[model samples]
Target: MLIENMKMAFSAIRINKMRSFLTMLGIIIGIGSVISIVSIGDTMRTMFADLYKEVGLTQAYISIGYWLDDVRQSDYFTLDDLERVKEVFGDEIAYIDSQSYVSADALYGRAKVKFDFQGIDYNYQDVQPVNIIYGRYLNEGDVKGRRKNVVMDVKSALQLFGVENAVGRTFRTTIYGSTDEYTVVGVYKKDLSPFQAMMMGQSDGGSAFIPYTLLTWPNDYFYAMRVYAKDDVNLDDFFGRLKVFIGRLKMRDAEDYYMATAVEEMGMMDSMMGGLSAAVGGIAAISLLVGGIGIMNIMLVSVTERTREIGIRKSLGARTKDIMIQFLTESALLSACGGMIGILLGSGLVSAVGAVLGVTAVVRPSVVLLAVGFSALVGIFFGMYPASKAAKKDPIEALRYE
Candidate 1:
């Protein structure tokens, strides 16, 4: 009976092939738009999250700067803030990294290097994840003693000595007006940042790490504070505590304010992406609505064109429910066929767009199922009105109409 109903539906559509195809247009566009939007959003989110981890957005940044209502200045995050932070949330945090960037000339015996140097405290390795392959990094003693010790990246070392074993070699480094000769305690394996590897092919992040105490700043010295939490849950509590701790330090006011962390920024981005996905999905649903209307209208027209046939069936002892079921089945079959085509179109479109966007386009089973199920819902909903009208047709009137 189901097969027979489906064949009848196809016969009607076959008779009006152009009309049927045009009617399914709405469903096709709707599903396709939805897939494209979803794919793009998912791809971007995944790519950004991965890059964020690499750039340390997952870690907290405790930055300080002066602000006068709307005016902003770059005078912030002092060593005092570091001291206060350690006093408040020292146990929860694994490392306390304090660094500031400055451009200076470095002399390695005869090789000259003029690059932006970074000043780091003793506990950088504890708070940040790093692996040393050559020699030991600077310690608490180095930072406290204001020692002129420095660690060189492989590229920097190679540039100076043309080899990896450049440890124990002395280099003359200058910060501001002071020039001091320092021995290379270690050489790193890879240094990859664009600035760090300016001319090197193999360097990953090439920058020198020097002790924080060696830094000489004017009336103003600002440091970048990064705190890595012990765990995920601790991160949430840690931020709140840090805020309160800063408040106690009197750096919490709007004027002379400090931007705390990137957590809020990352969360905002995720929320925006999610909203975009929903908006796109909603727009796609409209096509299914149009497709449903097409199914309903075509089914009604088919019934009208076959009124005499319907009457004959009723006269031959066919019940009203039978007539209703047959027409409903036809409507469902039409939409089901349209859904299969739409699925393929949507999948292809998402794959192509993802490639163009330079991100991975992923389609889960749930998405496919959602599209199919929604299409079926359109059939059941729109098919009802037409099927009901056909079932209610009086056999005498249907027969007399022709």
Candidate 2:
């Protein structure tokens, strides 16, 4: 009997092909919108997680309290101070370096190529390893001798000298307001992912590196240092002890110091992105309610049109429950078909956009299953009133009306 009812329902839909298609449109749009949004959000979250891992999720940043009113020169961290911390921390520390930056133009003949110059210690390479393609990274000799030497990206080297091997090439640059000639000691290749490259765009000039001593000479101090803890170390406990250690080292209170970790930053970013996606997805879901209402309206119209058929079925000894189940099955099948099409359409959209943006397309099977289930439920709930009306109809009156 159930199979017969489904067959009849399918026949009715096939007879009014155009109207049936029009009725399914709302469900398709709603399901498609939700799937695309959720998939995109998941992909973005994964990209961010990968980025954080690349930058060392276990890394911690320690900086001096320059914001405090009582801040003095003693509050500043010097090379001696950095060394002392390293010696004390020993095996617990994976890598440590003081990173400082200055924006300058490297004069190569008539062209003044711009680059962000970073002052880095010997241990800097260990913290953020660079792939040296042409020459060598900065060594202890470079830092101790305070040589006016630099390392740059292959792209930057090509931009400056129109060649890949720009090592031993001299360029004039003003550092800390003093104009001096600096020699390129090395050239490194920057490997960026497809998504990262798209975000950065096509840039000719890139970052250049130099010995920390050359930039911070005379005073040789820094306000902040980037530290990486070992994998085995507990970040929370290490940072707690580090803050106190630095505070005591600088003759300041522990509360005066400020420390932030990459893990904390990643967590905050994930939370923010998740919340934003949920809010936007919720707004998009309003279409589902609209689609449900459309199903209800159409079902009501269907009941009115099929009144004579209902009366004939009742006269043939069909039960009221039988009529209701048949109508409900028809509505559910209509909604389920729309949902399947929407899933395919949404998946295609996600792949196309992900390709264009150079990010991976991620679609969860759970989300697809949920969308199909919810759409079917929407159909059944909305079809209730119409089915009830059709079931409770007076057979004589319904037959006489037509």
Candidate 3:
């Protein structure tokens, strides 16, 4: 009986092919939009997770809140404090360093190019490593001996010396009102993520790296420190205690210090992404309601056009339940077919966008199933009125109609 009803439904749909397609248009668009948004959101989340993994989840940052008016220079963590942290938390810490930057003009021969020098210790790379194309990174000897050697990106090297490999070359720059020449020990390539590249704009000059010991800015006080914990350590707990320990060293309250971990950052980003996706997805879903209304209107027209047919079926001993089920099934099949097509369209969209963004698109099976089920439910809910109206028509009245 169910198979017979489906066949009848298919026959009716085939008879008015164009109208059926027009009616299914709404469902197709609604499901497609929702699927695309969901798949992209999932893809971004996956990309974020991969990025965090590459940066290491055990990494964290600590900074002094100098924005407070009462905050003094003495409140800043010093080189001694940095060493003390290493001494006390030696077992838990994998790498630690103080981060500072200086802006200066690099003078090589007749050329004067702008460059920002990032001051870091030997352990800095272990926490946030970089790609070195030529020469080697900073060593313990460089930091301990206060060597004026530096590592620069390929872009800056070309701008300064007109060459990609500026190793064994020297450029003069002023630091703290004193002029000195610094050698380029290494050259590296700059790497930025797709999202980062979009958000960041061009800078006045490229960036280079130097030993922290050489950057003596107003008594060498640092406002920030970067630390990476051991893989086996719990990042939250370790940072929590480290904050307190630093607070004690500074003779200040723990609340005065600020800490940021990759784990917390990852969670916050995921939440933000999820909320944005939901908000946009909800807006897109309004189209599905419009589609459902379209279905209802077309079903009413179908019933009216087939009144004589309905009457004949009733006269042939067809029950009212049979009439209702037949129309409902037809509506459902229409919506289901539209949903399948929408899925294909959405998959194609994901592939294109993912290729451009360099992220692997993630389309979950559960999401697909939910979209299909909801579309069918929309069909049944909207088809109720038309199906009921058709089933309740008096056989004598329907048979007399044109």
What local lDDT score does residue 47 receive in model 2, on the 0 to 100 scale? Answer: 84
Across 327-393, the per-residue lDDT of candidate 2 in tens digits comes to 9988887777778788888898989878977877978999999999998998898888888999999
Tell me model 1's lDDT, rounded to 2 decimals.
0.70
For each candidate, what is the lDDT?
A: 0.70, 0.84, 0.86
Q: Score residue 351 of candidate 3 by CA lDDT.
A: 85
Residue 242 error, candidate 1, Å: 2.4
Candidate 3 lDDT over residue span 247-309, tens digit each: 999988887888889899999999999999999888768888888899999999999998998
lDDT of 1 by residue, 8-69 (tens): 77887688888777777766667667666776677767755654554455467665553345
Rank the models by TM-score, top first. 2, 3, 1
lDDT of 2: 0.84
Steric clash pairs (candidate 3): none
* Winning model by lDDT: 3
